[model samples]
Target chain A: NAGVTQTPKFRILKIGQSMTLQCTQDMNHNYMYWYRQDPGMGLKLIYYSVGAGITDKGEVPNGYNVSRSTTEDFPLRLELAAPSQTSVYFCASRGTGPNTGELFFGEGSRLTVL
Target chain B: AQSVAQPEDQVNVAEGNPLTVKCTYSVSGNPYLFWYVQYPNRGLQFLLKYITGDNLVKGSYGFEAEFNKSQTSFHLKKPSALVSDSALYFCAVRGGGSQGNLIFGKGTKLSVKP
Candidate 1:
């Protein structure tokens, strides 16, 4: 199985532009997350979905939106991208379990806002 | 709130030597901790996790972590470091059982030199 896959591995956007980072998982996991990593900083959660049609704000959700349209897809959208939003974005998924399961991550997408 | 800490920003070790990456966490309830690794421009890969039964959790690629509840730490260890093992390491934690959210620490960059 492909586990998790992310599209648009790299992108550069002009300030105020909008873009979507796509994520898909074949594992049929019920948990999906979006995170961004900055140099020397920990991964910050952007948004998350417990299942299809459910989404919630995470630690760092101010500039992004997320939608879980199906069990296999969780996409993050950046609206009016700003320079502060430039970072490496990662998508991850896990099975629904009592104990936290290991997260399977996509390769990641690097975005730069100019 | 659950949180994690990687006290070190970077660690340098010689090939074939034992290496340790320190991690500590705080949570209201029982803690479920995890370790992940990331190569340059890649997504985070699961290394190991501590759920309950055993204090020592073994995971992929000859990596292991010791869960010290008294100390509130879960440190990653490798018996013999390999140059290829060089990467960025992250420590994460979540409240046990039914808590789907995770808290991540600032990552530590590990460099193994031959």
Candidate 2:
């Protein structure tokens, strides 16, 4: 399987600009998540979706928005981007099952807000 | 709230020697723990996870972790380190009772010197 894939490997956004980070998984996972990793810091959760049409806020979801319109796609949107939003973004997906907590992550999209 | 901690910011070990990266966690109930490794400028890759069963779980690339419930620790270990193993390692945890968010540690950088 292709597992998880993310588009726009790198980007630079002007302050207040908006953009969407695309993510897709071929594993048919029910859970998808977005996370941001700052320099020398652990990844902080941004948003997640348990299934299509079911999105939820995560620990650091304040400046981000997400939508899971299809079973294979979960896109993270950053509106009014700020310098603080400069970080590496990762998308992950995991299949359904009681003990299926194993997450498959994408290649990541590095963004810098200037 | 659940959280993960990696006590060391960086760990240095010589090639062919044993290496260990310590991790500890805090949560109310049973925990689902995981380990991921990230190479320079690359996204995190799943190594292994411990949801239940054996205390010692082996994972990718000759890596293994011991899950100690009483001590609330899951330290990554490898018998003989390789220079290729030098990378950033992160520990993550999520509570078992609910679909709690996965929490991650600050991350530990391992440098295997020849």
TM-score of 2: 0.96
Write down the lDDT of every candidate, Cα atoms only. 0.91, 0.91
As a whole number from 0 to 100, the lDDT of residue A82 in candidate 1 is 100
Candidate 2 lDDT, tens digit per residue, A1-114? 788999999999999999999999998888899999996789988988889999988878988999988999999999999999999999998887777887789999999999
Q: Give the TM-score (0 to 1) of chain B in model 1.
A: 0.95
Instruction: Write out fnat for all predictions, comma-separated.
Output: 0.73, 0.67
Rate residue B32 of model 2 by lDDT.
89
Q: Which ranges of candidate 1 are over 4 A from the true structure?
A: A98-100, B95-99
Segments in model 2 whose C-alpha atoms lie over 4 Å from true places: B95-100
